[model samples]
Target: MEKSAVYHRPSDNFAYSINKTTLQIRLRTKKADVQNVKLLFGDPYIWENNEWQIEEMPMTLSGSDDVFDYWQVYVSPAFKRLRYGFKLQSDADTLIYTEKGFYETAPLDTDFYFCIPYLHQNEVFDAPDWVKNTVWYQIFPERFANGDSSLDPKDTKPWGSEKPAVNNFFGGDFAGIIQHLDYLVDLGINGIYFTPVFKAYSNHKYDTIDYMEIDPQFGDKETLKRLIAECHSRGIKVMLDAVFNHSGYYFPPFQDVLEKGEQSPYKEWFHPHSFPLTGGERPNYDAFGFVESMPKLNTANPEVKDYLLTVGKYWIEEFNIDGWRLDVANEIDHQFWREFRQEVRSIKSDLYILGEIWHDSMAWLRGDQFDGVMNYPFTTNIKNLLAKQSITGQEFIENMSKVYHNYPKNVFEVTFNLVGSHDTPRILTECEDDEQRTKLIYTILLTFMGTPCLYYGDEIGMSGGADPGCRECMKWNEEDQNLDMKQHIQRLINLRTNERLLANDGEIEFLLPDSPNGIFGYRKYTEDKSIVVLVNSTDTEKSYSFTEPLSDIKDIYSGKTYTGSSVTLEGYGFAILNY
Candidate 1:
């Protein structure tokens, strides 16, 4: 037995409350090392005589990555408390794993077991139920459309006439979005995540000049209210970006600090290192990156917290916005987010709070702060496998297994999954303009777990590089759009909507490949029904055989029935099978 590889903890993903009465426990061991595991658990105070009374339940092998095999078991303690240990058996050895260390036999003392003192219902990781079912469409307002050209900014170019630049604008507004509500509805998008519609100087609107007012370039508050109402009427949820991490250079508080230096009442609102603030090279004060235009706000300040908290509540209270996507969320203090979650959720208990964090965000997703984070790790793995072709199918599955085990099931389900966004290159560009590869990427995205987000122009096969290049004006002309790609996406969305297994309905099991570059897939299943999603990442035809006979199998995507246990797919092909 590889004792060093065995691991477990009594908190976070390792152990957690799935609901008010049920507690889920997990154990990890080296891959293919342990033959079996039995969880020994009981109420800490249920002892009768001298021997601590406990019940043993066999742990099921939930999943296995490259290095570790994860085991899980669910229990509901009668006393709402638990003290647990594990008995792991390998081919040649059997060991009792406990809190103190490895023991030759199960210990009688409850001190030797890991503890969950009590299971509180509030501790269960509860995110808004609506988020899991949502398919998000991210709209960069400046590039989406221009319904009311009267609101165009000075020097606004004709829509789609030229390439996009950092400073260029095409006068996209709420009225424009309102005009295209039917287009989004037809695409099967139930949630719209608008990037920064608040008053800001930049076309991107990440730098907030005023938290309370809508950017005139986007439209007046009435236009935004109408937009939100239209979206709600169509059963679409609206999530506005909240750039509370920093303020634009023109933001009144930042301007006051820059002008007054020492005497400014808002000096403490920002992190100015010294008097006489300057914005050259590296700024004298802390800023977002080294960009002098965006100054990071000191959210720890009481007044600043109050102002931002108001901004958080004002939109939901007045306009009934469904969600807030926090910008630079990881850089801010946790206490502020905890308070922000409490403050915003108090108004709308089901309000979704998503954070823009690109790394492992377990710290912020403990049911106290963010309901979910921007799933950049997922984006990276998908891009590497499909777009870059740097990683093989087996490598992709192994890497993603680690990602799946990182968070609780509930938290993972609501994560914001995206392939392309305003900050990254368009998906078609990432796949080097190959429509087949781009379609494959969308197949994995829309069919994968969690809430998936599509960039504004990706569905129509728009091609562009990162940043300014990705923010091109939406092509409204039917001749200019890729109807095939758009239809492919629409079909995937329809499948996701009609089929519960495609969403977060059941347990997922990734079918590990036999070779490095072999075909890969995952099975999402309940007790009786199952859906298997297979992908052939290669450029040639490939065949995959089922371990057991699959009967009554139907290819949901193609509406074709299969008779055999094996299936064949063409290059860059995918299959959504229902059995």
Candidate 2:
């Protein structure tokens, strides 16, 4: 046994409450190093005749990746408290793992075990149940479509005619999105996550001038209400971006500060360091990354907190929006989010709260704050192996394992997983225009755990580099679209929505190919059915043979049947084998 590789924490991903009565415990060990694992658990105060009352149960091999095998068990303690430890065994060695450390035999003293003092229902991270079944379609509202030219901005250009810039608008509005409701319905998407749609100075709408109103370029409040109603009519959920971290330079409060200097009533609303506010090279106030055009708000102020919380609750109370994708949520204070979650969910208990965090966000996902953060780590790993080829297939699996283990199982299930968004290059462009590699990346993304998001135009092979280039208007012309890529994406979306095993909380295991050059595989399984997805990233024919002959397998992707153990795939090909 690799003692150094063994690890467990008291209360986190290692141990957590799945619900009010159900507690889940997990352990991580070096892959294939331990032959079996058993869990020892009991209520901390349960004792008789000076001896602790304990119970031992065998742990199941839950899943494995390149470097670690995860063991898990679910327990419901009679007293709603737990003190637990693990009993690990190998072919040649046996060891007891407890809170104190590893030992030759099980510790008789219960003090040496890990502890969960009590199970609190409110502490369990509960995201929206609908998110588990959702396939998100991310829309950059300004580029998605143009329905009412009458509502177009003064300088709006013809759709798909000009290159996208930071300041230019293509007249996309709620009316446009309203016209395309059937289009999204036909694409098999249940959720639509729009980039910032509040009143803002920029075309992207990230710099919010007002959180309470829809951008004039997008439409009026009633127009947005109609759009939301239409989306709901078609069984689609709408998630709007919330830019509470900062306000645009044109925002009324910031303008007042600039006009009246320190004497302004709204001076306390922002983080202005000096009396006379300046915004040339460096603003006197704290802003989003030194950009003077956007000023960060002082969320610590009671007034600011109330105003932001009202904004958070207003949409749910008014339009009945399904979720809010917070912008730069990591920069804000955690207390504000806790209050925000409480306030928003008070109106709609199951309302989804998503954050725009790019790194580890364990602090913000404790059920009192955001439900989940963007799964940027997954995106980074996927891009490295499939896009840049900077890492081998094995390296990708190891990195993915780290990501999987970084958060609690509940948090991992609702994470916003995506390959492309407004902040990144299109997926096809990331693959350097190679359709086959792009397909493989999508196969991995759509089939993997968590809620997957598809950026508009990615399914049709629209190619561009970052930011302004990636935000180009949607190419709706049949002559300009990649029909094959679109169809493949549609199929993947259908599989993700219909397959029970592909739920956010399914048992998944990564498989290693005999030759680990450019092949990767994983299986999503339940008690009823199992699926093995294989991707060959190399530019040559690849064949994989099982250790023993296998029967009763069907390829879901290509609709082919196989009865033998061996399978051959073309260069950059992918197959979903169902058994």
| RMSD of each predicted structure | 1.0, 1.8
lDDT of 2 by residue, 344-411 (tens): 98899889999999998888877789888899999999989889988777777767877887788778
Backbone clash pairs for candidate 1 read: none
Task: Give the Å error, residue 337, model 1.
Answer: 0.5
lDDT score, candidate 2: 0.87
Badly placed stretches (over 4 Å) of model 2 are 30-33, 48-50, 61-69, 90-92
Q: Give the distance in Å from residue 402's predicted Cα in candidate 1 to where it truly belongs.
A: 0.3
TM per candidate: 0.99, 0.96
**How far is 299's C-alpha from truth in model 2 (Å)?**
0.4
Query: How good is model 2 by TM-score?
Result: 0.96
lDDT of 1 at 481: 97
Q: Ten consecutive residues with minimal summed lDDT in candidate 2?
A: 499-508
Please estimate how well model 1 matches the true structure, expressed as its whole-model Cα lDDT: 0.92
